[model samples]
Target: MQIGNWKSTPELGPLYRQIREMGLERNIAELDAFGFTVLEPGVAAPMEWVRRLRDRLLDVAHERTGVPHDLEGGAHGQLNTQPHFKHQYILYYLLLEDPIFQQAVCNPHLLALQTYMLGFNCRLSSCTSFVKWRDEEGYGPTLGLHADTPVAHPIPVGKDTHTGNSAFLLTDYTLANGALAMVPGSHRHARQPGRGEGVDAAIPIEAPMGSLVVWNGNMWHGAFPRSEEGLRLVLTMYFNRAYLYPQEDYRRNVTQAILDANPKRLAVLLGLADANMWDSADGPDFRGAFDVLRAAQEEAGLPTTANPYEAQPDETDVQVAAG
Candidate 1:
């Protein structure tokens, strides 16, 4: 299908209304104070769209990364059975080239919510699809309890301030099914806290399918184990102040049509427009890029330009055996 073909549907109305009502400044303040916040129920794209996207992702995984995705068993389970499975880390832009995925990405309500939450000048840093099956067990085991910031690498000290990340659950997020576990307000802590035993301090976000969970990059969080028998799928996208590393090579991946069709804000997120038109610097202005996207989105009548993704449906497709 052509890119952005599904955008004309009426399914996105409620989401747009929600975005219109929410104030951007408030969302950012809440994120700053609590580390994370779950947006109220908003309109979600149809499940068929999500399924199609998943299918396309599996194809990309198999063809480019040699990761086999089992249609019946789910990608995570298949990968766990074979540790050598290689998958794409951030595939949204490529996925968006598909019309269905693009519709979901540009949903005005979701974009508005994302822009508001991240502050007006946010840009898409990374986009990834995570498939955790029953076999994978315990949040990939390798993932540590850490924040996305202070980044996993070394950078100039003050350079850390502009980074942030967000996650969208495309399925119901339950504690037993490897939901994300986080410490509220932990983003304010001076250093990463040790993972302690028990659940008192940890909060597992149990939101309905299609709920969006956004957090600051410094928030102390980690994925929970997938104890359930079915696949726990989620789509995560990170937004930054534009000075941080982007998850995808957006400059190369975006089609010129998308560049032309998209508003100036969306173009910046895709790296189609340069933020520093006035300044002649070899390095891209991460902050300026983010700002341009935010402004363009605002001009387009969106409340916020924050990233948003679909989660799950009301009914469970598969059941997990009790331990």
Candidate 2:
């Protein structure tokens, strides 16, 4: 089927209008040059909403692990039993945990950046949280710097980011509080970092609570060791291009009621608008593909009703197709 016209550059596309409308032109430029950008507090989400998100995450953590957490202090129970990585309590599939997470996934600023990185067909990969504190054996000596798209050998390095990460700071991020460590422009390297490699180049990303730090999928990143006395809370909302498999099975796991509660765009992000493998004789629905295309345009601030799939070919084109 025919497809709609897509602008060659981000600045020339509808997505750029959304970015410009949100005053994120600089952040977009940073992502191009440095492979990452930080959206300060009051830009990503409201401070009150960020606090509520933090509280809800902590409550859910307590419910699952049966350990009350103090964001300003510390917790006693170890939520993660795996010895391979014990520095933080990991909360997975947070989209299923609360409505607040759903709201977070729809954050306009985040959607703008994610759409820019992964395109309009971008779907959510995972929604998780990392609750870190000072470990008895220390947080980390090795930075564990690596690219998110490690599945590819000699990963393609360029402007296209197959995967992207938006980390929402629930608590104040400081060097002492174990802020994320990233190597600037490492996405251009086109390959994963070797063991203990890029340590000297890694720099801590410090920001206030409610801020959002986003990066390219190819960027090499890790975290600094926590020396402070409290928990460092961060909500990680990961995204991937439509062709990539998501870390969580959101398409299969998301309930109809959940889809109904959120905006239509949320359903698109959950992979509902795209056609999937058909098990029945009916086969895949072609409308879903057009719906996804329209949704992409809508999110990019373009006209949603103009579906190229429905456009009829002229007589010359018809004769060409017949030939």
Q: Give the distance in Å from residue 99's predicted Cα in candidate 1 to where it truly belongs.
A: 3.4
- The candidate maximizing TM-score is 2
lDDT of 1: 0.57
Displacement of the residue 271 alpha carbon in candidate 2, Å:
1.1
TM-score of each: 0.64, 0.87
- lDDT of each structure? 0.57, 0.80
Give per-residue lDDT, candidate 2, residue 218: 88
Measure candidate 1: CA RMSD.
14.8
Q: Model 1 over residues 1-323: C-alpha lDDT tens digits? A: 22221446332343334444554445655676777777544534555665665566567557654767664455532333222333213344443545545555555545665654444445677666666665444534433467676454332333123556655566678887667888787777635555552235677788765666777776778767766665666667677665555666676667768655655656666554444433354654444454555567566654444421113323333222352
Residue pair clashes in candidate 2: none
List candidate 1 stretches off by more than 4 Å.
Answer: 1-30, 40-97, 117-119, 136-143, 150-161, 194-200, 275-298, 301-323
